[model samples]
Target: MVKFYQHTFSFEHAWDNVTYAFWLRYPNPFASHVIGCDVIDRHVDPDTGVLRTTRLIHKQGVMPRWGRHLIKNADAYIVEESEVDPKTQTMVTRTKNLNHVRVMQVEETLTFTVHPENPKWTQVKTEARIVSEMRWGLTGRVENFGITKFMDNSVRARKGMAHILERLRHNAALAGTPVAAAATTGAPLDC
Candidate 1:
């Protein structure tokens, strides 16, 4: 069997401007002129296969804060996707690995979703999963084995975080938007 690497980053927000930028920058070859961001809630019923919450992000000027964050993550994060013999009933039947149990596990699908909130916001939903008839590992990444290392210590993390926030704040100011007075209160842009 062969495996290929696929990288994907998705940002679903309510900011039309940000959505415009995303649609313009990452998803397509053309650039967008929209601004602002918001969240889109999609309610899909697995039992009935009914899908709802079909929202579209549309903006033509400056984007929202969350949108900016999405852009940043797209530029920095490292992602990869590949296919394997997903655990399915058919797979187990053909592999001859197990037959006495009368169970079959075939191919599996893996996907990782990372959404980092603002610097001020700490909690986030970072997920790595396999979607199939059964569940798989939800384990964390191994230590010292990631894409890139930006910081060496708490000071570095704090400093890096501050620099990122400062850049966002600066961009907001440049866009003629009301700068969050407390956005860079103590976080100096030392990078």
Candidate 2:
């Protein structure tokens, strides 16, 4: 079975600043479950000037007691692919878990664009698909649990992004620089 979810939200920050902050979002206070993030590959297109990146993320996950029998550990490895088109002021990202698919698999896509009504703000559209391949009555239970957990995680993830964006805003004000410029300084945002 496949379960789907979608959400639309806006950030009070500009597209450039929001996209820049996305690269620095991992170590934010709201995302303590994320243990590690490493860039697997990254490059800027010479002709298009678009930035593309692949990253690996390690997250300490929570699994229901019943799920313990299906998987030995709750740790999850995720692969993320992202592209940022500076010219178009748009960013798109897709992520999926690399482990524990037999129990459940959740895939999510996110798009960031300049807000139509407010140029200074950015709009984010999130879409997710949850699937479980288990046979028998266990499939329904697992997929239902997957959707519930997904919604909970989504809320926390949004808070994490907002937390990172606020820090960027603060840093920009403190340094008397653009938020994007502050984001480029490679400072760790770890709590």
Candidate 3:
């Protein structure tokens, strides 16, 4: 058996009272692998008074192929600068023990910054890490181990990403800002 995996990071560095959101999708698999994530859902510091909220979803596959066992089709969603429960108190909140998955570890961090255009706007930064392991034993024990498990992990990521892009367009319309090409000279690098 072999393992395949991918890593990605994204952020909205500058905006006025903006709510950023996006999703991440993993196209392959990893064995005994670690997945780490940090989300800065909200921030109110001396420098920045910005707020961010995120929702993450993950799905994994466990099946045996004709030639070898493999894991495929994992996805995640990270909605930023949304909203949160006032009762809760944390710069970053995480959903540990993701359902029907083996999670070895999870960690996160959030940083705050103040926006010049709107002092009410806050710049938020976050980093997250996750660790996971392959689980083929369960499927192998089942009656049909040959059935391919096309786990769709990116459902939330897809929804969030689309929502954020749409919102950005709407905001631009309200501000009467001209739309530019998707790949502009000043566009941020997609990592």
Candidate 4:
């Protein structure tokens, strides 16, 4: 069986700023489990003008103590792929673990866009699916644990993004540039 989760949230910042923050969300205090992140591939689609990126993230101490015997290592790798379309002011990202499929697999997708009621604000939709194929009546327990952990991680991820967004706002102010102007002009962010 698979467990699913969905949520919608908004940030009090512009869509451009929110999308920019997504690229700099790692290494925050809220995500101390993240050990390293590397960009494996990045390029702009010639026809669509959409920016595409693939990243590999290394995380440690992610496994629960009860399940430690099933997996040899406490470390895990995740593959993240994202597409950003500046014209439409939309960004979509998908991520999934690269190891430990037998115990459980968690896949998450996030979409960012401008809020309908407020142009200066950004809306985000998050969806996730967690599945476990383990036998001996352990499937349900494994799936429950996966979903719970996923929810906790989601909260941490949001806090990390908020932290990065606030930093961007402060830097923009110091540079004497409006956040919207900096986002629209594609100014290089300090992140």
Better of 1 and 2 by lDDT: 2
Q: Put down candidate 1 lDDT per residue, 26-121, tens digits, no spaces.
A: 222122322322233444456544332322233332223433432332211111222112121010000111111111111212221223543222
**In candidate 3, residue 70 scores what lDDT?**
32
CA lDDT of each candidate?
0.26, 0.88, 0.34, 0.88
Cα lDDT tens digits, model 3, 77-179, are 3333333222231234334334423422233344334444544434445444444443555423322221111113223333444455555566567767732
Error of 4 at 123 (Å): 0.6
In order, how many clashes per candidate? 27, 0, 23, 0
Candidate 2 residue lDDT tens string, 25-122? 88877788999998888889999999889999999988888878888889999999999998999999999999998888999999999999999999
TM-score of 3: 0.30
Q: Candidate 3: list runs displaced more than 4 Å.
A: 1-16, 20-91, 95-97, 100-103, 109-122, 131-171, 174-191
Return the lDDT, model 3, position 190.
16
Worst 10 residues of 1 by lDDT: 88-97
Which of the two candidates, 1 or 4, achieves a greater lDDT against the reference? 4
lDDT of 3 at 15: 28
* Candidate ranking (lDDT, best to worst): 2, 4, 3, 1
Count backbone overlaps in model 2: 0
